[model samples]
Target: MARKIIKTNPNLIELIGNLKDKSYNEEVAIWKDVASRLEKSTRRRTEINLSDINRVSEEEQTIIVPGKVLANGNLDHKVTVAALNFSKTAQEKIEEAGGEGISISEIIEKNPKGSNIKIVE
Candidate 1:
């Protein structure tokens, strides 16, 4: 049987379209890179392990997870994290560290071109 390919959310699709029209060529290239990644392997669902989250640097634009963010690692730096779902412990830990936990859609809305975004699987 062939695997089904899931489509990205309409909001995300719109964001990608906007990104394509950006004036800055470098930014447009970066956005295209991220969009390309998102387009491949349409599983519809995504999950991020907290252990991986802890490895990211604070200076990064933002971390986005398509599925859920778990609470299995220590978060020492203050960084913005946006995802589809977050564990109870993950939410608390992010807030406790002075970081914002938001939805991926919100992140895309704020930074359509993904200018500094680091996507964690």
Candidate 2:
């Protein structure tokens, strides 16, 4: 038998609910995809580095991490990054590079239709 895991973080629970709701209302799969990724166990969740994001993305793009963003390398161009969480230094570096590091929920609220967004994980 498998044990049921309950998410205790109210914010996270709310975010997931909002994602699913938005997906249903907008008929967009991206929000559902992001929500599912976020529902995974902590160990199975994504932990992406700055270098990977930079390599997989282009300038002025909107990207989703579906997990945590780490400050492992450097970013040269400006972009908008939305993730479940971000390391302190990662957020700082993003701002320094003229980029914006925002939360997944915020992104969802900003772009309800989920247009032109790339998943970086």
Candidate 3:
């Protein structure tokens, strides 16, 4: 059977351009990697709730997501979360929890080796 083609979001494209302009190479690489995965239909589609993020321990390095991160769950840990898209509530919650809600580009810049990165959904 042939696989379905997934289209990249325009918003994501613009965001990537901005990251690149800012010289965030790691984030650009990560975004490109995720885009490729989506195109191939090999990337898992998971909906990450806010509660799930909240439950993560502080020891966890970073939470990466290929899809959007919702704000339905609570976050209590002070870990970093990197995703393609983050809802406004989710962003606020993450910040309120003392954690950083960042884009995949930001995470890539911080960890160029791509070590300790987790795909949340």
Candidate 4:
């Protein structure tokens, strides 16, 4: 028997490829985990909210979301967030709270070793 592969969006395929390359080049397992999650079926992909991140994260923490970050609530403190996609309101809210919202690729380039990072979804 062979394992079945799930097809994902083209953009997601590129993201996953980059993540796998970064994981191998940097020897970081977290990147691989993030890549794998992004490879899931679109319906199965991770989708998180600011409130959920607030629940699981601490102030000034670095967090990553493999799918999308939605602006459904408030952020209590400053934090850095990286995600494949962020809602317009989410980006605004993050910055308004003195936090930063960045693309996952940018975060990967800056932190290849994936240190002190929490996967929000």
Candidate 5:
């Protein structure tokens, strides 16, 4: 048997709803994928660090993280990162590197079709 996910955060619930709606309306698989990822329990969700982002990303790329972004290391290039949550230092580091750290809903609003968006774990 499978367990049902019980998300407590109202903001998260809203984001997931928006993601599903966007995916259905726009016929975009990426949004659906992100929504499923976000539906997981907190312990099962991803926690990516700046170093990993720097290693796998290129300058001026758009990356979406379904979970939280940590500030463990430094970022050397400019990129746009959208995630469900961002640590204070993580947001600061991205800004310091000339990058933008925004929310997933904002990203979906900016790119409804989810064009050229890369999912980072």
Candidate 6:
């Protein structure tokens, strides 16, 4: 019998590998959890919206979206958003509202300890 492996995007594979490595080195549970979620297929992956971020996040929070972020609503306060992908409009909206849109790997490199980070899927 052979074990089946889930097929995933190349980018996601790299990202997941990095996340697992980071988790081992840093021993943080969040990184591992995020990687697990990201391992899912594109269809099942997270798809977060700006409105959801605005509703659930607080000022100066660092939020992670495991999937692409859609631009649908307004953001009242500035928050750091880390995601796999972001729509052009969503990126603009985030930047316009004094927030920053960064990739997951970028955020991981910046915050190895994963402090003050919230996964908003």
**What TM-score does each of the candidates earn?**
0.66, 0.96, 0.67, 0.91, 0.96, 0.93
The sequence of per-residue lDDT tens digits that candidate 5 reaches over residues 47-100 is: 999999999999999999999999999999999999988999999999999999
Two-way TM-score contest, 1 vs 3, winner = 3
**Of the candidates numbered 3 and 4, which has the greater TM-score value?**
4
Better of 2 and 6 by TM-score: 2
- Distance from true position, residue 22, model 3, in Å? 17
True-structure RMSD for candidate 6 = 2.1
Kindly report which residue stretches of model 2 are placed more than 4 angstroms away from their true locations once superposed.
Answer: none
Q: Quick one: RMSD of model 3?
A: 4.8
Estimate, for each residue in 1-121, the C-alpha lDDT of model 1 and write its tens digit.
9865666678666655554555255455655544555555655456666668878656434787756788888778788998767999999988887788997557656876677777776
- Top candidate by lDDT: 5
Q: Against the true structure, candidate 5 has what lDDT?
A: 0.95
Off by over 4 Å in 3: 3-37, 40-44
- The alpha-carbon lDDT assigned to residue 16 of candidate 1 equals 50
lDDT of 1 at 61: 47
lDDT of 3 at 4: 62
Q: Rank the candidates by TM-score, best first.
A: 5, 2, 6, 4, 3, 1
Instruction: Name the better of 3 and 5 by lDDT.
Output: 5
Model 4 regions more than 4 Å off? 1-8
Better of 1 and 6 by TM-score: 6
Compared with the true structure, what per-residue lDDT tens digits does model 4 show for residues 1-121? 9557766578777888999999999898999999988877777878899999888888899999988999999998999999989999999999999999999999998888999999977
Q: Which ten residues in a row have the lowest lDDT in candidate 3?
A: 33-42
